[model samples]
Target: MTHNTDLPDVVPIFPLPGALLLPRARLPLHLFEPRYLAMLDDALKTPQRLIGMIQPNKVPGRSGSGLHTIGCVGRVTQFSETEGGRYMITLAGVSRFRLIEEVEGFTPYRRARVSWAGFERDQGPEEGDTAFDRGAFLQTLSQYFDSQDLQTDWDSLKEADDELLINSLSMLLGFEPEDKQALLEAPCLSTRRETLMTLIEFAMRGGDGEGMLQ
Candidate 1:
């Protein structure tokens, strides 16, 4: 793992579409793409099984085929070997990075020179939405879960800290791709929480009152 320094020696990158990972959160990924499989193998061999998760600008073989500028670097915390030699791994997010430049590499996966200078500032609880009531949020989540018939281990849920609870909820909920990205890019925890509340409200509304005529 790279220390909390301005510059680092090596930066490992993992680019995918519509996937967002935030700091202090966990993301589980299944390796199937040949290029990414190679990337995962290379990462596992190294000390910092660290990968920068960026969104691809366009689909492969399409006109615009590149990735976005900013992404988070996650380190492999747990991994499992599957029957087909595929990997089931969980990444714990560390910090965000700004893409500096792409380097030529042997594998198909993209490699980039990145810098952490941009993300060193405050990513604290959001302003204006500072009046967050955790108790109310939990009660609301319980009601929402009941309505959806979703079962959770209440003891664990009750024990989760503010950051973990909010990030986990935002990640698992069935939000639109754009919306999910928005939540991932939110600058602070309060903003994320506020965005989640809006999402929860929308879900409660059910299809925005416009379903198929059938």
Candidate 2:
């Protein structure tokens, strides 16, 4: 993990909604769009090979839209260019950063000046045995998964520690963008666990107008 002190003044980002990558988590991307393919190409040339995963407020004009401010910065740990003009890459998250401002650059993809000051703690591993309500979280998650008819490995789920289990479910579950953003912005693991539980219950009750839960 790169120290917040060592993070660059600016980093290129891919403003994709409904797509999220959290610190210490891994996100695999299919770079098929021309602009994003170009972004991937440029990222691989640098030693850091980093990209910020963030949600955009609205449609981007030439200048792009308002970003949600906080995002996870990850390094391109794997890359492969397909013969069909596509790129496959895996980003291993390093730290979260706040978008300070946009940088006017010549690159095809957008660039942002970011500040990692408050998110310095994201560099290390998640705390062990957090005060989060693990039992309730897993139980609700099991109910939600069963409702969705999604198979699960109960033994493997038990092996996941607090941070891994919480963040993994947060990312993998199909929650509304607002719900996802809430989980991302939660101040700590305990809060995030509680938020996840609430969101699941809401979905189960058909709060989103859909009979099924996300």
Candidate 3:
């Protein structure tokens, strides 16, 4: 496990909208673009093998250079190369970071200097959600999944711990980019769970009062 101090002050960033990586979560990426491939190559050479996963802000009039201030950093825990010259890698989330500024560089991909302050909890043990209502949450999730025509391993989800279940859902769900960013920026497990439930309920309602809950 990498501590906050062990993380670098600057890291190559991957600005992917609608992609949320939470602490202790794993995000698998398929990198084919030449710039990202180069970024991966450079990252693999470093000791930490870290990459900042940030989202490009889509707010009106700020789409060009605006990015959400917060992002999660992950370590390259698994890697493989495909015959098509693409790279498949699994990044194990280390901690969430605050983007300080974009570093001026000649690299093909973007890089940023980040601060890990106020996020020390990200490197600690898994958080417990005492307020979590698994049965009710699952009921709502089941309805949401059914509405979206999504399928998953129910048994696996049932066995997962509270943090895993909520964070996984927060990351993997097809929510809007801003909603996903909200989940990522949640201060704690319980807060994230609450945000996730609200998002699910809103989705079930079709974002308005039109659709009936399944």
Candidate 4:
């Protein structure tokens, strides 16, 4: 038999600039700031160490402005102590959420009331087979990597599963902020793949093959 636990009433928050997380994916974070150290402590004390990962326009002290309405919630699945009381942690994406409202009267870190509606909807590629222009896609990726003079294990790349291939390529390509948002919000893996190709073509034509390398 299986049982379900009521969702936790508390949500922890973490904001990053220009970073995104897909469902079931993982993000590694280094927590050293005093505010975030407090967050880590709160999470460690709670049964659910859930944090909302958002992208800020600038680092906290620099600007603390421009945040996306959508973000992913993740749990600190792994944590370890580091020098100087810092923390190294890996957060596994649980779901995407929409910022409902910002709440005050809490800890130093920013807090928000969020909802995960439409998060688990039909957003991934169809189970089983995802059709794509494999030959053309590989050719484009190879040429792009080559033009950038970046070394990649072709064999490993070839062997990479579709999710890994798409997400990795998406990250490597330095797409504009809006473009990255579109890719993350794409309806399915195949659609995301298509967007990736479009970005690659744009890069190739603009002599921006190195953009992805950085």
Candidate 5:
């Protein structure tokens, strides 16, 4: 378990669009790019084995390739080297950090100094959503999945608790990058659940929805 004092001030960042990692959630990544492979190598040497997962802001004319202000820091909990020099790793999210500044360095990947001031709760235990409407949410999800031609284990989703169901959907859904960011930046579990519900409802009503398990 990671505590507030255990986190580092600066860490390596991987800017991937549409990839969201919330606290207590897991993100699996495939690293074949040379720069990211190097980044993984360096991260493994650190005591925390932490890496920042952020999305590249797609808005035009923004600097530093337009990184979002907030990103989640995750520890490399699972790692395996594959054939063709590729790496597969699963990151267990620790906390959300505000990007203070991008550090200039010779390393192939980007690093940032982050502030964890507002997200101390992320280092604590899983949160419960008192206002979650699981029945309605699942109904909407079923409709959306039908529209997208997607499939999933409904039994497992029904069995998952509020945090796991909401967070997992927020991570796995095919919403836009900005929508995913909104979910990530949400202040709490209930807000994220609301945002997720809205996104799904919007997608069902002719929004640009794509990507799902078929």
Candidate 6:
């Protein structure tokens, strides 16, 4: 799709820990806070309705938390204004970027000049990037789900491609913030798959199956 520009030079940043949005993946967000609500309002008027999802330097409750340098940029694909004057929207991941610096903006939310130079592959079409190890993922999934008393469609799992499988699970699961960040910052899809397997295995072993993504 041709855009106003080939790439967005700057984007509004959303610092929500544990929210992982990979390229082509979708993330739904609720905007109630004044800062983020305002950010959404401004983004709607821009050429590219893009928002950068990143983790905080420190978890919100912890001290010294600012924002992470690496994040995935997403475009607003779905939106709705709630009766309570809130916004419910979904973002479709566009590409990953590295934050250079935060720029002062009128919006209450923070803005950053980010670089997408190294992630050229993310913008273009996805190839059969990597061979998905369905058996391994299912084996671990079975154990975790069974232990958690969760039921899912085996057929759907079988049909989902590697990217969808990994990103879907990553977003759906209640992994810890750090673990989620690790999966998001994974160098490639293959690496994310491997990290996912490791996480699942850990969750499976942790008693009662509510693996707290250590």
lDDT, candidate 1, equals 0.72
TM values, all candidates: 0.79, 0.90, 0.94, 0.80, 0.95, 0.88
Once superposed on the true structure, which residue ranges of model 2 sit more than 4 Å away at CA?
Answer: 58-64, 209-214
Alpha-carbon local distance difference test for all models: 0.72, 0.79, 0.91, 0.69, 0.90, 0.81
lDDT of 4 by residue, 1-214 (tens): 0011333433666777556676566778899999999988888886767787876542245333456667777778999989999999988766667777677856998787777667654234422225866677889988877766777888887887777778667755666655666666766778888888877787778744332421
Two-way TM-score contest, 3 vs 4, winner: 3
User: 7-83, model 5: which lDDT tens digit per residue?
Assistant: 88998999999999999999999999999999999999988999999988766665454898899999999999999
lDDT of 1 by residue, 1-214 (tens): 3455633545667876557788767899998777878888888888678877877654354223376667888888998878787888898877777777888877778878887765653233313335779788878888778777899988888887777778888778766655666676677788889888877776776754221110
Q: Native-vs-model 6 lDDT? A: 0.81
How do these models rank on TM-score, best leading?
5, 3, 2, 6, 4, 1
Best-to-worst ranking by lDDT: 3, 5, 6, 2, 1, 4
Worst 10 residues of 2 by lDDT: 205-214
- Better structure of 1 and 2 per lDDT: 2
Q: Note each model's CA RMSD in angstroms.
A: 5.0, 3.5, 3.4, 4.9, 3.3, 3.2
In model 6, where is the ten-residue run with the lowest total lDDT?
Answer: 205-214
Better candidate number, 1 or 3, judged by lDDT:
3
Candidate 1 matches the true fold with a TM-score of: 0.79
User: lDDT tens digits, residues 119-214, model 6?
Assistant: 876776753545776887788898889977898899998898777877899888878777887887887888888888888787777733332343
